[model samples]
Target: MKPDIRGRQPANRRQKGAAAEEAAAQHLIQNGYRILDRNWRCRTGELDIVAEKDSVLVIVEVRSRSGSSNFGTPSESVDRRKMQQVRSTAEHYLHVKKQYGRPIRFDVIAVMLNAELTTASIEHIPNAF
Candidate 1:
């Protein structure tokens, strides 16, 4: 397991993150959201999922935790600083994409994965911010 730049997380962490994001996206799709983007990145940060539902643009932040819930729930991990970063990134996306004057909503999709990473349970919170 190769460490990332700061040597804090192993490469498998990324794989798990990707898997969690995929699960979150599928959950959204099943709920009638049209996915516009996944892993949208810019200088500020990354937006995990961008979707549209009922003419409202939804910015989804996907969070996941595996194994025991010793630390906390996944959605609880998104603190104030992270919310600022997501808002900044979303602004950048809106300006770049020229999507102006559209209703927007922020959502959080929390996924809990089993130890073996075989299944995921998801909780979708709309207007999370």
Candidate 2:
């Protein structure tokens, strides 16, 4: 297994990311967002979360990283290519679900986990795209 710059194993990083995504999902649920799907995927790409608030469908891209990592903030990691892939994946989801004419928006949930990976700081950006 490859070790990160800080000597942490790759599996540890994956575990941290998964934990962060779970926390982000729970945070959204507590904020009145109904989760429709998690890890929805298509030929284009994968969406981290699909949720709804009121009548609007929200596609959420979850970005997660350790607090002391060199990867920069989670939000900064979602670059233009990532946004494009997310947009394409959302289109595929809409077509497959036959969810036409419904209001849609892209969102981003940035999660920063503590050193122990138990606590998280979450930033929700609605209409991110």
Candidate 3:
């Protein structure tokens, strides 16, 4: 018997994540954020969202999990390692965009969905790191 060594996320989960990102983007736009990019990637890593508001460059991390518990809140999912990766990745992005001397901040948007796939809760933490 062979083993499932791919370690890939299920299609449904990927879809849910994509939906969450889109929702997050909309929320940001409504809140006066100008989205610069979505799913920006490089050899270092992938950034879920990049935006600007009030002349400040913002790096947003979106996380979504379907459940009824707060145990897996999105903010809790971003650990120190992930923050470090984000920092390096953001540097790469800034260099690529030639955005030197711009104030930058990291933000997090957490989405919790109901069993029916409806939005249950959303929390946006700005200047998270």
Candidate 4:
């Protein structure tokens, strides 16, 4: 099996993550954010979603949880370490794309999927950190 960046992930988990990201992207679009990139990679890490609205560049982190919320909400999963990684990656992205001197914001999108993966609940938190 081909392993992902974090290591080998079960097919179902990967699929669910992909679905969640897609839903997040769609939600952003629906809310008038223009998507700049998805799954952007750098030496630091990957940016789940990069978008822009009213000339402000937005860095979005997407987290997904299935079934119960026993472990906690998906947004709570993005701790300091993960935020640092996202920030580092966003810096690399700005440098590489020459998007300097622009306003920036960090956002977290939590997606909760039902057990059958037929429906999802999305929560968007702007200026998350």
Candidate 5:
């Protein structure tokens, strides 16, 4: 499972993810994306970050890989099942609010971490699976 970054996160890849998310959030803010929620969850799944950009619902997925020793690339880990869950969660969110007129998309935020789990780099892949 991924670490929670909404709260007090340790100084590791966990926080790296948070940093990437923070950067992405700022980018969105500057690019006119209004943040709706962060790390929202339900009984079925969770959405890492949710926001409204250009009148569209965005479901963000943040992934962190420490040196790629075992887990390969961060973006590569977000397989089909995870995307399905994100889509499902987005649908659930819309269903709960009865809002279904806006377009929805999936975004991937990849945070590269050093061997010690520190921040290496951040890559934001919008509309990525």
Candidate 6:
């Protein structure tokens, strides 16, 4: 059973996802990353997170799974179709927002959690795609 987020907060799955995302964002900020955009979207798809670290345009995909990477973690979940969508999303972000113009790379932020929904570890694979 999931914990109740009432009497002080929300009480649903979506709210929990938001909470997890926020926590992950904080972790990134603490590691010297500047948050560029969160939940950036286009007609094609959405990038979970976007940040800049050391003058590099980092397109981040946040995947929260309820276990370890033993069988298959979140980062490994970015299949070929997903990669294509990410590429398109990155292109759109570059042209439309005009924020990231040079020196860009794709990254995956795999967030693993325990059965109780507590964060176990965050694996960051830079230049993954």
Highest lDDT scorer? 4
lDDT of 6 by residue, 3-100 (tens): 44553432356654665577678788999999989988889999878888999888887776764467787777889999999999889999997765
lDDT of all predictions: 0.91, 0.89, 0.88, 0.92, 0.77, 0.79
TM-score of every candidate: 0.90, 0.88, 0.87, 0.90, 0.75, 0.80
User: 66-127 in candidate 2: lDDT tens per residue?
Assistant: 76758798998999999999999999999999999999999999888876686568899998
Per residue, candidate 4 scores C-alpha lDDT tens digits across 30-64 of 99999999999989999999999999999999999
* Candidate 6 Cα deviation (angstroms), residue 20: 3.6
Candidate 1 CA-lDDT value: 0.91
Looking at model 2, the pairs that clash are none
lDDT of 1 by residue, 14-119 (tens): 8779888989998999999999999999999999999999999999999989887799999999999999999999999999999999999999999998755644
For all candidates, what are the clash counts? Answer: 0, 0, 0, 0, 0, 0
Model 4 TM-score, all chains together: 0.90
Runs in model 2 lying further than 4 Å from the true structure = 1-11
lDDT (tens digit, per residue) of candidate 5 on 1-129: 444566544466456667667766766787788989887888779888888877888888888766554857888989999988888888888888678787888888787766445567777888895
Error of 2 at 97 (Å): 0.6
In order of TM-score, best first, we have 1, 4, 2, 3, 6, 5
Range of the 10 consecutive residues with the lowest summed lDDT in candidate 2:
8-17
Q: TM-score: which is higher, 5 or 6? A: 6
